[model samples]
Target chain A: MDKFTVHTGTGAPLRASNVDTDQIIPAEYLKRITRHGFEDGLFSAWRKDENFVLNKPEHQGVSVLVAGPDFGTGSSREHAVWALMDYGFKVVISSRFADIFRGNSGKQGLLTAVVDQSAVEQLWKIIEEAPETPVTVDLAEQIITAAGFTTKFEVDSYVRWRLMEGLDDIGLTLKHVDEIEAFEAKRPSFKPKTV
Target chain B: MGRTLAQKVWDDHVVRRAEGEPDLLYIDLHLTHEVTSPQAFDGLRAAGRSVRRTDLTIATEDHNVPTTDIDKPIADPISRAQIDALRVNTAEFGIENYELGNKEQGIVHIIAPQSGLTQPGMTIVCGDSHTSTHGAFGSIGMGIGTSEVEHVLATQTLPLNPFKTMAITVNGKLPAGVTSKDLILAIIAEIGTGGGQGYILEYRGEAIRALSMEGRMTMCNMSIEAGARAGMIAPDETTYEYVRGREHAPTGADWDAAVAYWKTLPSDADAVFDKEVIIDATKLSPFVTWGTNPGQGAPLSATVPSPDDFTDEVDKVATEKALAYMDLTAGMPIRDIKIDTVFIGSCTNGRIEDLRAAAEVLKGKKIADGMRMMVVPGSVRVRLEAMAEGLDKVFAEAGAEWREAGCSMCLGMNPDKLSPGERSASTSNRNFEGRQGPGGRTHLVSPAVAAATAIRGTLSSPADLVGSN
Candidate 1:
């Protein structure tokens, strides 16, 4: 994980409510052992359509994904978040996010911002009208700004800190190695120990 | 401020809680499968770490294991390697394993509950999302990633934050034809699949109380669909009755004490939730997904909404895209959507009761031409029970394929798959694009509906096929 604040860049509006993990990275691509190099697999099924927003040439370098409510629903596959990050998406703006996906994304340092439905609609309209429109999502301020519209979102303080520091769950846990070791030493006789 | 089931389980499992730190929660049971365990095992090996509590951990081969020819080597090289890797890892780590063809071998979620390994007020973790199914026993169960799997493997504990509780109380009596599947489907559609996010949902009220253990399992199995970490029903007489006499359940005096503890698992009458959703079961009908997401569903009698009918522009575009991908015409009755395949098994509804229900619908009617139907049991024990009851013969006589137990067409992880452009009516939880197979359009339905669809070669309720003989 890299330490860098996320901001919406070259936003290409593609709004689909209840966009499921299966659509993010189909189960076919899940066969691979390595988590790396899923960029090509992101939205592979939908990218076949020439008219799809993601297939457009101008949106190639876009980092912001403006989506509808209930984004990332179905299947608690962390691969969905990985594919998005691997595909260079820094921030996903939606009215709401699936619980597991939201937690998984936050852990992976992917900024998942939940704004009011009206703000989502506004962003959707602006990005749809002007393809490659850029929206600034300042994690430090917890605000998303685009085209004279601004929205504030809330995230867990610990998750926000982890995202800002680019620390994964493992990294966060490793930070307390000494404490973990101390706790391990206090374990009861019947309790098992890691080698 | 009464405790919800999740809080009760969480509090009981919390070994320690310090300032600015999460709880060091002890896990009572850890289940592993082939799909996600390989990487975790590799991580442990890379770190030269051994499993902390082999007695508490159990491994099973599913997801990638074939439902046919248990003796033969898997044809898919990648899947074969994954299964082999799990066996090697479990053997090296001294963890108990129930491999393919073993009576204990089955869908991990189904086997855990049936074996009485999933007890009330326990904390369970698995590398698979449907682990929430264990919550039906009043346990706090949720899925974890490979790294977390490794963490639990090495430490026998999981660091976690607290979750808010949501009570989805389904009141009133469910109509005669409406099953637990219908109730859950209706809830998913109503909540738009993200309604339970960040909340542990407790299923309460009359409708949930009336459900059998298998039905409760089905209800909790799809909690992930609503973005809930887990869904639970408090233990009662029904839960105790289901657990009694099970192979691993407590015996004699221990059983009495266990039941006593289980009886106190329910939320107090004054308990308040962060969110509450009241559903009237009578209003719900047999439901089916018409689009690529479970939330994009309607009652069996309703028509697929046209893009023009959507108030939001994004919704309109999504409706159009889903319609195009599904090759469905707007405003057409959902029942008129023709399906080439009908699948009635998955962790969601693939149990003994589900098999019996499908068998009742397909007792004598032959499958219509061009319709391929399969009845795959969730576990080997379920298969044996179905055979003993002669339900397998009924399915075979009705022109349906009776497959061995595994997560068979719910996901095309193994040999079961749909060819490109094939559409299916499935009882599985998801309806995403290509969920069944490449270019395979899936419509989530109930077992009875899947059986009826096989007979009619289109979406039809079981009531429609009734008396047709």
Candidate 2:
């Protein structure tokens, strides 16, 4: 995990609500056991279209993703977040995100910024008119700005800290090793009854 | 002041809490599968940790297992290794596993509930996301990661943060042809898949109360689709009736005591939820997904939304992109969207009841020309029951392929896969791009709709086929 500082990059907006993990990285691409190089699988079906946003020349190297309400719904596959990271998406801006997907993203050091629907619509309009319009997402300020409007967003304090430090869930859990050890020591030798 | 079911479960499970520290919560049931458990078990071995509570842990093989030829060796080398690893790991760790061909072997979610391992007031965890399916028994179930899987394996406890709760109440009676599947699809469409984030949803009201155990299971199975950690229906007489006389269910005096405890699991009338949503069941119809996400769905009678109709510029772009991938023209009637394949099985709708429902529709009818149809049961037990009822023959006579049981085309983890550019009407939960296979397009529908679509070779409701019978 690295220090939590906001990095800004812009792309041609590819906004869709409830963009599930299956769409992020389809099941076929998940054949391998290893969790590396899923960037190629990110939106693989959509990427086939020559005119898709990712294929647009101007959106190249963009790290910020502006999306609609209820983003990242369905399937708790962490590969979705991994794909986004491998494809250079650092922050996802949406009105809301699926709980498990957001948690999975947070665990992987990807930032999810929940903004108001109106602000999201504004950003979409700006991005639609200017495909390469720059959108600034500030982790420190918990705000997203594009065009002439700026909107404050919310992120859990603990998750914010983790993202700032680029810490994953395992990294966060390992931070309290002494506490965990003490708790483990108190466990009974006998296995608990199955519910 | 209203506490949702998720809040109740989370509060009950909290063992200890300290400032800036996660609570150490006991896990009641831990379900494992071949795909994710192998790595976690390896991690446990490297750390010299034995499974702390073998009784609480259970494993099954589904993702990589083939639907055909149960006795033959797995042809896929990687899949074989995964299954083999699960077997070896479970044996070495003294954990219980229901391997293929075993009567208990099934999709973990289905087997857990069917065997009474999933019960009210329990906290269930699995490496698979649809573990929420257990919540239909009023349990708090969640999907966990591999690292967390190892944590549970080593300690039988999960570090947790609390979640808020939401109550989604569906009132009034569902009209004929509207199934529990339709209701869930409608809910997902309204909430846009992320509606229940950070909340466990408690489904209530007359409509939910009327559902059978299998129906309730199907509703909860897709809780993950709406970003919910779990979806619960309170344990009642209906639940008790469903669990009675099961192979593992409590018997004699213990059954009475269990029923008493289960009765107490429901929320009080005054219970408060952090958020609330109300849906009118009468308005829902046989729903189907039109786009890549489950939320991007419409009633079977509706037409695909034109991108130009979207006022939000971002929505327009998304609509356009979805149309392009789906190869569907905007404003076209959804019923007119032709499909090449029809699949009826998965944890979502692969039970004996689901097979019977599809069989009822396909009994005397034949599949339309150019339609490729397959019926895969969720478990071996389901397959056997379907066969006993002659539902397999019904499907076969209707021009559908009847095969063995497993998670077949739902996620395409095995030999069952969709060819490139193939479009399918699937009873499975997901409709994401290539979820059926590479370049495969999926239209999510209920079993009834899937059967009808198989006959018509396009999207159609069961009502459309009822007249023909």
Candidates 1 onward: DockQ, in order: 0.33, 0.32
Pick by TM-score: which candidate is best?
Answer: 1
True contacts kept of 2: 0.39
Tell me the tens digit of each residue's lDDT in model 1 across B1-469: 7877778888877766787666777787899888767767877788787887787798888787777787888998988877888888899999888888898888999988898878888789887778999989899989876667877888778777888999999999999888998889899888867778888999999999999999999999988888897899998888888988877787877787777777788887777789999999888889999987777889999999899988967668878988998999988998889899999888999999999989988887899987899888999899999999999999989889988888988887888988889999999988888888879999988898888889988899888886775
True contacts kept of 1: 0.33
Instruction: List the pairs of residues colliding in candidate 1.
Output: none
| Candidate 1 local lDDT, residue B16 | 61
Model 2 lDDT per residue over B1-469, tens place: 5455565666666655777756767677899988767667877777676787798799999888988898999998878877888898889998888898898788888888777777777789997889888888888889876657877787667777777778889999999989988899999888756677787889999999999989998999988888888888898888888877776677777777677766767887778888889999988889999987787889999999998977967567777877888999988999999999999999899888888889988888999998999999888888888889999889989999998778999996799999878999999998877788887888999999999999987799878875664
Off by over 4 Å in 2: A1-13, A49-68, A86-90, A116-153, A162-195, B1-3, B20-23, B45-50, B308-312, B466-469
Candidate achieving the largest DockQ: 1
> Candidate 1 overall Cα lDDT vs. reference?
0.83
